[model samples]
Structures are given as structure tokens and as C-alpha cells.
Target: MSEKVVLHYFNGRGKMESIRWLLAAAGVEFKEEFLTKREHYVKLLDDGALMFQQVPLVEIDGMQLVQSRAIMNYIAGKYNLYGKDLKERALIDMYTEGIIDLLDIIMLWTIETPENKQKQLSNIEQKAKERFLPVFEKGLANSDFLVGNQLSRADVHLLEATLTLQEIFPTILSTFPKIQAFQERMKALPRISKFLQPGSARKPPTDEVYVKTVKEVFSHIFK
Candidate 1:
């Protein structure tokens, strides 16, 4: 029998894109349970379905998993996308953590307050310049992929982070030639390219409802 996998998350991509990308790249057939209603999400939390009270939960092979990174790591291990050995896996983890750091800053922009919005924009610019972007640029200085010479989970996470940031700040990667080139290279992959085609589910939030919904869902955390 085929493996049964169900991914639960909000309707938008947000934290779940990398996991979705991994499944797609691995040619895994899975079901998506998008929580489109606020009450539905709260219901899951109240029912103890979410251990950490977060979305992007995955139910696979008789196991339910929480946390985006954990789910991605599990899937990557199954698909051999983690790395070849211990040292390579360590480097991949390092790069993945760095990408998550960037993702945290990008997520801060979802808050709808004027002051917080401005602060997040400034923070993204600063972090991109002094921290995240430089790290990735240098990391990619020797190879197109972030960890090892092959396409590891780190590269997938980095692509997601780069695309997320690019959506908000279109010209953010102009100064970082290597990172920009890496983004292009990753997008050209057969699986990823198809996943990114027009009308694909991989598209991130771009409409007014996206901002409103994000603010509503994250109100507790942002406040």
C-alpha cells in the first residue's frame, strides 16, 4: 500500500512551503488539510491535536508530527535529502537554522501595526545586509547548493526563505550575486519549476486577505 500523508496548515504557504516542496520534489502524494477558518484552527488547538499549538502539522505513516523544521527533517531523512554522512548533515543543519533565522525576520512583517511594520522592514534590511544574506552568499561562494555539492534540505529551505523575502522586498538580493544566482538555479530544477508554475499551490499570500488573515492568526504572538 502507498504511504498515507496528510499535511495540516493554514491556507497560505507561510512556514509549510519548504515541507510541501520536499514532498513535491520527492514525488510523494499527500493530502493537504488547510484550515481556512479561524474557529477550525482554534478547535484543533483545543482538541489537543496540535501539541505545540502551531500549524504545518503532518500526519504520516501512522505518526503525527508538529513543528515545520522537525517535519521537514523527517521527510528529508526519508527522501535522502538530509546529507550523505554526519559532517555533511551537521553543515546542512547549520544552513537550515540560518535560513529559519531569516524566516523569523520575514514573518515579523506580517504584523499589521504601522510601527511594527516599519520596524520589521528596517530589521529585514539590516539583518539581510549584515547577517543572513552575507552568510548565504559566502556559503554559496564555493557551490550552488548551501550544504554539500548536492541539493540538500538546506537548499530547499534557503529557496523558500529567499522567495519569501523577495515577495516583500523585491530588490533585496540585487547586491548578493551568488545568492541571486543560487535562487535562479534552484527554481530551474524540474520538480521545483513545476511546483512554481502559474496557479500552483506553492504561491505565497499576495492579496489583502492574506495580510488580514496573518494578522488575525498571529495576533497573540505579535502582541
Candidate 2:
């Protein structure tokens, strides 16, 4: 009895990528179905195919799930990707949740208007990034993995977030050496390395300048 899992994704980078990587790394069998903005979701909603009316949904053995994080947690628990002990599992959640907070800020910035974007950078985002770095840096410094001594689902989630952010928000990781190293290590994982292959069709950042600048900053920090 093989389980069935289907991922609902849109064009470009978003929560779908993390789910994709986690499932792929675990060697899980699933289908990737993409939806466009115009009428795709409408059709799903009309037919009740997308139970939650949201994307990145994973259907497992006739059960449908929505919400990106919850889907990842479900996959992690299903595949034994959660931490070894209670404490390690908690740590994994802690670090993974912390990274989520950072990504949230970046996502908000991604959709902001130019004037308000600068305002966000200064008034909210700038301070927020500085605050989160120490926590992520310390987490990486504390152990080889975020939740356990070995690789866990939390690492896959956060590592993908970091990679996406390095291209989308480079300034945030500019001074964070531990996180830089962490990203490098996670990317080098055999399972994870497969994601880096060309022709992924992952969406590019709306701002190329920001992407280039951040890549340069990453190089500087790693150097």
C-alpha cells in the first residue's frame, strides 16, 4: 500500500520549494501539480479538490492537508525526520520557527512597494534581521543539526529558506558567518545537492540588484 502525496505549487519561489526538497530528500513518492493565478485555484475550489483552498497541500492516503509548515511537520513525522529526543525536537522546532520569522519579513518585503519597501527596510526589517541572526548563528554553532545531532526535517526547511533568502535578501546574511557556513554545509548534502541542479525553473528575485548584492555579500562572508 503505497501512500499518495500531491504538492500544489505556483510559479517561482515560495513555500512549495521547501516541501519539494523535504519530500525529495526523503525519497518520498509524490506528484507535483502547479496552479496558475487566474482560474486554476478557482477550478480546484469549485471541485473541492483543494480542501483547504490553499497551495502546497499534500494528500497522504486520502487525507488532504493545507498550510506549508504543518505539511512539512507531517512529512517529517511520517518519515522519522523529527529529532531523536524531546529536547532535540524542541530545538529543531525552535530554530525552524525562528527561521520562519525571518522568511516572513523577507516575503513581506518582496511584495512591498518601492517607497514603503525602504520604509520597511529601515523601520522594521533592518532591525528584525539583526535580531534573528544571532539566534540562527547560535543554533548552527550549538550543533551539527538544528533539531538533532543528525540531519532532520528542520534543517531541510531552514536550509532551503536560507538558500532562497541568500538570493532574495543577501544583506541579512552578510555578517552571519555561522549561518553562511550552515548554508554551505546543508547545500553540500547528497540529497540536498540534487536541488541545485540546473533547470529547476525556480523564480528569480524581482530585484536583480538585490540578488546580486546579496550573492556578493555571501561570498565575502564565506571568504
The sequence of per-residue lDDT tens digits that candidate 1 reaches over residues 76-179 is: 99998989999999999998888888877666566446777876787787887788888889999988788777889888888888888888788889999999
Candidate models: Cα lDDT each: 0.80, 0.68
TM-score for each prediction?
0.86, 0.78
- Locate the minimum summed-lDDT window of 10 residues in model 2: 213-222
Clash number for each model: 0, 0
For model 2, the superposed segments whose C-alpha errors exceed 4 Å read 1-4, 123-125, 169-174, 201-203, 206-223
**What range of 10 consecutive residues in model 1 has the weakest lDDT sum?**
203-212
Model 2 lDDT, full chain set: 0.68
Among these predictions, the greatest lDDT belongs to: 1
